[model samples]
Target chain A: MMDFALKTFGLTKSFSGKIVLDNVNLNVRKGDIYGFIGKNGAGKTTLIKIVAGLLKPTAGSLELFSSSDLNKQRTRIGTIIENPSLYPNFTAKENLRVQCKLLGVSDEKVIDKLLDIVGLSDTGRKKAKKFSLGMKQRLSIAMALVGDPEFLILDEPINGLDPTGIKDVRDLIAKLNSEYNKTILISCHLLGELAKIASCYGVINEGKLVKEITASELEEACKECLCIKVDNIEKACDILENKINITNYESINEDTINIYGDFPNSASINSELLSAGVGVNSIIKKDKDVEAYFIDLMEGKTND
Target chain B: MINLLKADLYKLFKNKSFYICLVLSILFSYMGTMINFAYNSFSNAQSMYSLLQMPELNGIYMFKTSFRGGMLFYSIFIAIFIASEFSWQTIKNIVSRGFSREKIYISKLISCSLVSIIITFSYVLVAVLYATIKSGFGKLPSHFVLNLIRMILLECLVVISITSLFVMVVFLIKGIAGSVATNLLINFFSGDLIVLGITLLLEKMFKKDVDVNKYWMFSYNNIFASFSLSNDVVFRGIVVCVLSLVVFTAIGIISFKKRDI
Candidate 1:
């Protein structure tokens, strides 16, 4: 059986009595790029911090790989919490070398290889303090990758990056997931970019995970809802159910019943309603993006 | 762990304030040399003996005095540097790289102690060599060698204890300004208060009416009283060093482990 890479059950956290994360349950499976999506202050960073062992959860159980030794599991997990933590005075090679030494991995050649993997091999002699924001972000990634971890958790990894830098980081993350076969959990504000790489996703809001779905499932399940306005409400509801054979419709008011289905087949549906003694008032179709999908999830629309 | 220590040392060496502190030490120590020259030029040996109330003046004592002077302040500066690691957010990088929190804390402690040791010894070395050139050889006090060793060891302990105490504070406080300011302030005020309280209690219990002023006794400044200890008194200094190390390091490690990074 393939095991989960990370799991949290009913995780709750508070800072000085102010609740940030409340009853969050999340699980990321092996070889999966899990997108942790949320707006700002939605407890994304808080959840990440708890998972990284940088914060103590007030209430919850966090399990990372079924292992006897936590230290051993920690060795396989690489995390960049909020920002890349590094010694600004050290060189890139020197930084990785130190990390290697701490993990008891004495191979010196791997330092250069790790830096090259992060595209920071040419940043020779420049201190991390002197690096530009994008370069610093890259160096931080290089630092996280030093121990050859099986799972990488990055919180807003592309935060503050330019468009080009964002693309570079996105490509790097893709490479890490595909070429290196490492599982990744990344939280970001860039929904479209996240949709590109994430195979699975968990939408978090107010510290609780509202929904968890695979990319294919989300594509299938979170489809756009079609709205239609007809003259005769009774006939429209009857024809839509009997003739159209699509039952997914909600009564918006006396004259409108919102129908959600395959796209704008409004012409055929409206004609069917009119022939059934219903007058066509208007038909409107709304396209739902991932952002709207999240809004729906937060609004308790998971049932639909 | 040693790798972290090495990185800590590397980071500390890059700070401009550290270099400036050394320059200030050199400037202060050289002023002692100028005073010695002035005293030698104007005063006869008899007048010097009567006025100073000491056997003789030598470069080693002048150097030792100046070198060891105000080391507590120097150590406070070191505390601020260690605290800055967290403030600058660089500590996150090292910890994210799979280094244990314990290893990182110990590394900073070890690095700070070693730096204190080196700077203390270096200051002494420069002062002694310069004094020897400026002033002719005076009688080498029998206690000089042991005193120098004790001074170095005491200085190291003082640095370790103070830095570890500050590490605990930083771990609890989670910021540079709070840890540095609070630690230096508390150490400055309570260090003397604690030492005085202990010294008074010890004196009362032992029934020793020993004049306190005869020796630099029972305060943070006593950390510099390396040459004052006789072979019989060496064990006392050991007790002080060990107790401080155990207590401060224990608090530091425990607090760090419990703190959310």
Candidate 2:
């Protein structure tokens, strides 16, 4: 009944004197598709592992369901860290049965339903070793859903999937959040894919949480701009600054400039540029995607 | 803990290697009896002069021989089973499911002990059947039967203790090949020969009478040998076996809890 599904306070972990996660404070509210974004070895997996209770933190505290007793709280959570933890010799259904046993769920119907949910119901009698990476990932997801956990933590759940597989998993994640009201803590390198379903975002860099913002906040942060391609970039800047009194703009290169402020009409700007002998080649509106925003955040170009 | 044990048992049942090891152990047990019978027959046909012609073949002797020879197979099975968890990365799933590492360790130990017990019982059953068919229950006395049952139970404890040692090796090494190799080396090479060699060297160097057998009761020849089952030897063996079980189980549990995976 906690407001937040998960919250970490100064969660730090080190390996052999090398810091993997350094004072990372993260939060995932109820029914949030919290997209954890970072590059490979950016401590994403390390943090996820700590949250899953697979690795104890060297320092810090984590609360799941507002309880600091992670071992007890972990029963209400499911996780797939790094690769899908599965027995290759067993079939997908068999693997799930094993997971069901671990979770103390005896209902065979639940296993069947989960397999159907993950699009693995048709894989009859095929051992997991024979499964492709995508199939294996789906099966891992099914395994994680065995006990119908209220909170799910998945680390790079779509790493090795094909485009269709990625879409399936994305839709499944969305469905789990929207329909089942499950709070998800997911990390993936593909920011574009993450952008499709993530309701909240957390950017991690060098083992530190650099930014935590909602999707709407990210949308507002990625400001819209008008990009103009001109023959003389300096002349165009001078005309916009001196004639039109628009100084809140920056030149991207020799032929391009991004105008940040709003102007009345493109025709007037074009006419002004033409009168000033600046050849306007093209005018286009540019919108920043989550990937670009993430890059900017990681590179310290954006203020938190 | 009970639920965890149930899950561990489920995994063990699903493992094909468990059944394969059981089958091999049974065959090895029967083969031991057959070979002994063949050797006795050959000696009688050749009329070779011997100190004791055709040593008595009883159910207890056959069971003891078969259990000792089959111990390695069971140990290897346990190693591969534990190692497969690491290789397949399924330990993460179990650990993340909120079971304490201590419970997980205890569950595996119990499951592996069950496996050892099943295999030992099967080996003994086959050995008993073979002995009955070959020798018609030789020298069936009530006291001897009671003693044999007592010895079999004690031997089971010893086997479980040894199997715990293998489980510890598997957890410590965390790899199939390394654990199996280390288990084999310790189970076979470090038993009596190494103890005798060390004793002889110490005696030669320091001129002292070092009782190797008294110090080391882990040898196959001493622990599994057919003897009178004295009160002193039985008590000491039980103490040593219990101590070994505690040590191995402790090491395995501690190592497993501390490991990252």
Could you list the CA RMSD of all candidates, in the order they appear? 5.3, 5.4
- In candidate 2, how many Å is residue A225 off? 4.2
Native interface contacts kept by each candidate, as a fraction: 0.38, 0.80
Off by over 4 Å in 2: A225-286, B45-52, B201-207, B214-217, B220-228
Q: How close is candidate 1 to the true structure, as a TM-score?
A: 0.80
CA-lDDT, candidates in order: 0.72, 0.84
Candidate 1's C-alpha runs over 4 A off are A104-106, A224-286, A298-303, B10-24, B35-55, B63-67, B70-77, B96-100, B141-159, B166-174, B177-232
Please write out the lDDT profile of model 2 over residues A17-98, one tens digit for every residue. Answer: 9998989999999889999988788899999888887888999999988988888999998899999888998999889888
Q: Which DockQ-derived CAPRI band holds candidate 1?
A: acceptable
Candidate 1 lDDT at A49 equals: 75
lDDT of 1 by residue, B1-261 (tens): 666765566566766657776666656556756676667656665465565543245665564455444454455556667776677666665665546777877787777666665665566666666777776556666777766676766656655555565556666676666766776676565544655666688799898864342222224335354456555455555566567677777787788778776
In candidate 1, how many Å is residue B209 off?
A: 6.8
